[model samples]
Target: MTDLESADRLTEARVALAEAMALHEQGDLVAAERRYRAALAQDYRPADVLPLLAGLLGRLSRPEDALHAWDQLLAIEPDHAVALHEKGLTLHWLDRTEEAIASLERACALDPDNATALGNLGVVLADAHRNLEALRTFRRALALQPDNLHLRHQVRRLGSGAVPFWHIPMMNDAPRNDAFEAAIKAAIGVAGPEARVLDIGAGSGLLSLMAARAGARKVVACEMEPMIAEMAQQIVAQNGYAARITVHAKPSTELAVGAELDAPADILVSEILSSDLLTEKVLDTFEDAHRRLLAPDALVIPRAASAMGCLVASENLAGYAFVGDVSGFDLSAFTAFAPQRLPIHGTMTGWQRLSGDVELVRLDLTQKKHDATLARLSVPVTASGRAIGIVQWMHIDLWDGVTFDNHPDGYHDGGWLQVLHSFPEPIDVVAGEVLDIAAGHDRITLILWPLPRAAD
Candidate 1:
């Protein structure tokens, strides 16, 4: 090409670049994008032009176009931190999570000291439900900018989101801890010091630590929640049981015989029971452990758990289960939507028992499998009142002679709360009468229904 023609092309490209910058500053995004593209077509310093074009595209609400612009810039300057970071943001906006994470991760790696890039990476990780990785990324950003309130908030939010609120209170419950420790000690005693133990749902690493303290040589524990699992590992290390306990941040179902465990565990200790017993999938967890993680004759802590309760009649308790007559209106139909089971602080909640304590259902944890069960229970009435529901608590039979019951009368301020399994509707009965009720579990839930007098 002639020198004059080349010079004229260079002048035209510089003018396009200058016009694009001016249009971008004036908020004329469409015109700015046109000018930026014109400059790029003329090959006028693309490394600089691409970012401005991409930023303009993002401002114009064209995330896909912005991503293409960023990609073009990345193809030219692969290590361009700004291009990588903005590409990550655009990908996230487009709901392409995995790619966004990869882009943001690259940005952070290229610019290790960039707090904004690190924070953005954390946000993408969190959006993808990789909360543990997000928490770690936030912590890294926090380390760089120690006084960043947003980063601190992200850390706290992720940590809380990963762990349940009841965990701390459950940990502080001395009675529950003692019962579990007694069970762990007994299992270790029976299996000897060399016993291999597996603890599922290792909250705070307490159960595994108990096993370690009981002289179990190899204790493997798994917690599904990553934050809680990490905390458990820290607690285990803090309590000097790190050498004995190996905590995996995974569910027991994900654990394998040759990987997480050297061999089948001699004892299986898990406390994943919810207030109502089945909500946490305790049966499924135990069944999986028995099938894949434990020996055929492994000693299972809480070998049996029984749902114990008595018929209850309480004005305060009834208010929670059923409602009616609001502002002289019959809101009784709304009662159909009332909670089937209400959690009640047994000692603090005022209630009267219409019948003596009766065992509603008992779960044998040692069994390899369980089917849904329903049985007829006839409760002999001792007092007369409107029976709102059966206020029930758990009676757990741990290792030989180690049993714990959160009985509504005496057990209070513990991890377990007595659950009021409400009836389909209120029933009135006289003293010295038998109220036949269908009581059992459908594997995943407790089945409690009041039967008709004729059926009884």
Candidate 2:
């Protein structure tokens, strides 16, 4: 090429580069993108211009174009950290999470000290629902930038958000803890210290720690939630039971007899029951434990748990369970979406019992097998009122005599709240009339519904 033509081409590329910078500064992303591409076409420092173009494309909400620009830069400078980071962001915007993770990981490896990159990586991991990994990434970033409020917030959110709200309350519930410890001590006394105890859903390692404190030599606890499991491990170590208790961050179903446990556990201590007996899949978890993880004659901590409830009427609860007229509209149709069950602290909520406590369903955990069954329950009403539903609590037979119940009358401030099994609609009953209900479980959930009365 002639010297004059080359100089003209160089000047044209410089002009395009200058125009792109000016346009970008003016917030004219579309024009800046055109000038950037024009400069690149004229071969004016393609490497430097590519990042600006890619960023401009991203600002324009053109992820595909930004991705292409990033690829072009990466092809030229394969180890460009900023390119990789921005590319990861664009990929995340495109919902290409796995690719974004790979790119961000590469960028992090290249620039280990970059807290912003690490934080972005954590956000992507969280979006992918890889919570434990996200929490770890956020923690690493937080360690690098301790004073960063966003990093601190992310760490706290991922760490605390992964745990259920009931865990703290359940841990602080002295009565509940005492009851479980009593049951564990009783089991350990019978089985001896050599008993291998398996604790399913071991939140905070409380139950397993109790077992270890009660003289159980070997305690294997499994929590399905990884965050809670990690905390349980920390708590066990803090309580000096780390050597005796091993907390596995895996669901009970994933645990095998020889793998997580040396052999089938001699004692099964699981507090997987929800406010309502079966919502936590207690029956399924227990049945699986018996079938795989527990010895045939293993001493189950709660040998039996019965769901006890009474017909109730509560004005405060009615608002939560049913909705009728609003500002002016008949929104009662929205009642179809009302909650089937509502958790309530019995002492705190104002409710009147229409019938004495009736046994809705009973699960014998020692049976090793359970079938979903429903039967007729005749609740003898003692009060004339509008019955919303049955307010249910639990009566757990932990061992021979070690029993616990969250009876609404006096048992307050415990982890176990009396759940209201809300009905489809309110029923008005006479003082002496009997209310029939279909009461049982579907293995995973308790089935309680009002049955139509026979012809008057």
Q: Whose TM-score is greatest here?
A: 2
lDDT score of residue 199 within candidate 2 = 94
Q: What TM-score number comes out for model 1?
A: 0.88
Worst window of 10 by summed lDDT in candidate 2: 344-353
RMSD, candidate 1, Å? 3.1
lDDT of 2 by residue, 63-135 (tens): 9999999999999999999999999999999999999999999999999999999999999999999999999
**Each candidate: what lDDT?**
0.90, 0.90
TM-score of each: 0.88, 0.96
lDDT by residue (345-450, candidate 1, tens digit) is 6443998899999999999999999999999999999999999999988989997888988887787777788899898788997899999999989888999899
